[model samples]
Target: MREISLDRLRTLVVIADLGSFAEAARQLNLAPPTISLHVAELEARIGAPLLTRARSQVRPTAIGETLLLRARRLLADADLALDEVRRQVEGLTGRVRLGASTGAIAHLLPQALEHLRAVHPGIDVQVQVLTSQASLAGLREGTLDIGLVALPQVAGKGLEVTPWRRDPILAYVPADWQPPARVTPAWLAQRALILNDSSTQLSRVTNDWFAAAGLYPQARIELNYNDAIKSLVGAGYGATLLPQEGEAAELDRRIVRRPLRPGLWRQLGIACRQEQVERATGYVLQALARLRQ
Candidate 1:
């Protein structure tokens, strides 16, 4: 008997997921006949029928159910092995996908990416700007290799999040608009407010701060992104809240950020599946470690 092939195992896994040979073939870029032949060969090698077709729906047999679990593990292991070998030969070459929360994407990630690129030119870093929920979802679904999100993992429960940085949340006011030396709930309520939309964790936190302060923002405008909020504030629209690090440059002229009187900070960090840690992530982890220093 011939040894079962890795390709056959992968094909079976895809078919099992998609529940259609044709769909699996499309995904693998293989002809339908080729996929069918590979599955047939795999079944013959094991001396068990792995699938039964009825009215175009293919169901895995009991033995196939058992094999499916193993096949998935084998495929995952094979991929990781290949990733390791490629990294060994090329020295951090290949692509790493990362998702960043809106705040991190605008401010923190640029410096981190620049530093990483300067040190390791071979690695290709791909960044997706997403909301915190979207970023966490991407990390869990394998669509992202790593992600930077607000700490506490609001969206997904099982991520391995390491502290990247602690940014003090500051109230940003257009230069020349503030009279109060410090922010109070009453002080905040009296000001014209421009709110960052609800898509960001920061926005939600800011909203809660309002609730805690017994002040409801009379929001004059709401924007989904940081830049837009900044632009509006610069135009004298209203005050907005953001992290200190993210507003450092804006702190120079158009905007002035003051620490909330009570003082609140948000921890931002990189998140990965505990099991997906690899060479590229090691570099990211190293970068995150540097932030702590």
Candidate 2:
């Protein structure tokens, strides 16, 4: 029997997913005849019918299902191997997959990325916006190389989560409101407020600040997107509490930044596997360290 072709196996998977030979061909940009030929060749190699068509749908047979499972794994390994070799040939040393929240991505990660581009140009860092829970889960699942997460994460097996930075949270209010120089929980909680949703760590921290002051004021609105929340504050919808990450976080003319009295800060952590870091991943980590304050 001849060695199975990767291209033919891919065509089979695509056909099964799309459920039409023509659709698969269009999706794969292969001629219809080629798609048929691929299936015929695979079936010939295994000496069994791989697909059976009924009423405009193509279904894989028992043997085909078995092969499909193995084919998927093989294809993933092949892609990773190809990427590894291509990186070497293309003057790239490593690829690191990093995950963090949108707010961190907006302010904190830019500094790290800039450092990497200048100092370790050969290392490529792929950034994904994810919640702290999702980022930690991805690290544990071996899908992420690094994670910038909200602090206070429970340390898990085979993972090290350490504090990276602590940025003070500030109150963002409308410029026209003529608010005081410093914002106190008691002062801001009395007026209309927009806050991070209960899901975020920032929201919990702010809620605690209010509770400490013997106040439990409800927000006029709660949202996850920090930028959009700031926009609403700019429009005089209400005030919000958000972290002033790295340097000066300036909004527009309609909004003003005020420091929180009695001091509240959002702490961030960098997480990685317990195993020794690879060179590329190390470079990425070093870049992130530059961002620490």
Candidate 3:
């Protein structure tokens, strides 16, 4: 039932950063005893020792470290909330934390951010590469303001999902290698194949495609990065299934991309907290839409 004081939480963070109460007090413009009292009050409220005092340094206990982590996030959110209010009054100028998959980061975000930067120079966008599931978890935890993830994602409560684009999965082979007009699972099975690792949703979809055709290809190599897979394929290592995206001329010259017989595709979408669908987060979605157009 006791509410932790923001001032005391901030004091705890400063001490953790400086590793000395004296330094924390100097930085915070408070006396050493005042800093110590702030920490002590927090410890008394939490019923745990927060710091270990040594000859010259102070460190947080395990429980203190845990609390410090939460406290930092809480403090950051509070700061961002104030910043958001100021930005709303002074035009668009706030931070948007975005989580996305590797492909989305490599192929999509650059263009989206380019458009966003030109339009809203004040808004700061922070992007992290993460799997769809991890991005979803980050959205739920309030760590990320928006997510660009593969579609067919389970839209549980509190999320607003918008389908963005559908990228067809294509087979990348050596330029010199000749293949059917429309590649088939049977055709791919006859040769060694470079594949996405089993951890990815793309790999799972590819596996199902192979299963439906009653073919299990020899996986010469499994990697998580599209560029790596393309490099290997270009070096005559093996063919791979990858989303169709614009590539560099060097990669384009080395490999030939072909569509599959049945046409497999991966759908990508944007997700955000339902309540955040109309704020700075929505600005990002609008930028992405412009890129699509």
Q: What is the TM-score of each candidate against the true structure?
A: 0.66, 0.70, 0.68
Worst ten in a row by lDDT for model 2: 85-94
Candidate 2: which stretches are off by over 4 Å? 1-92
Tens digits of per-residue lDDT, candidate 3, 90-202, equal 54877889998777788878888998889888888899988888888899998998888777789688987788888889989887889788899998888889998887788
Query: Poorest 10 consecutive residues of model 3 by lDDT?
Result: 245-254
Candidate 2 displacement at residue 235 in angstroms: 0.2
RMSD of each: 13.7, 12.8, 12.0
Task: Kindly indicate the candidate among 1 and 3 with the higher lDDT.
Answer: 3
Q: By TM-score, how accurate is candidate 1?
A: 0.66
**lDDT, candidate 1, at 11:** 93
Q: Who wins the TM-score comparison?
A: 2
Give a tens-digit lDDT track for model 1, residues 1-293: 46779999999999988889999999999999999999999988888999989899888999999999999999899999998788745557657788875667767767777788888767777888776677778887889888777766654566777667888888888888864667766787788988777766677788888888777776788776777777787777788777766434653477776778777777787778877466766676666566662
**lDDT, candidate 2, at 71:** 93
Clashing pairs in 1: none
lDDT of each: 0.78, 0.89, 0.85
How far residue 280's Cα lies from its native spot in candidate 3, in Å, is 2.1
- Candidate 1 vs candidate 2, TM-score winner: 2
Candidate 3's TM-score: 0.68
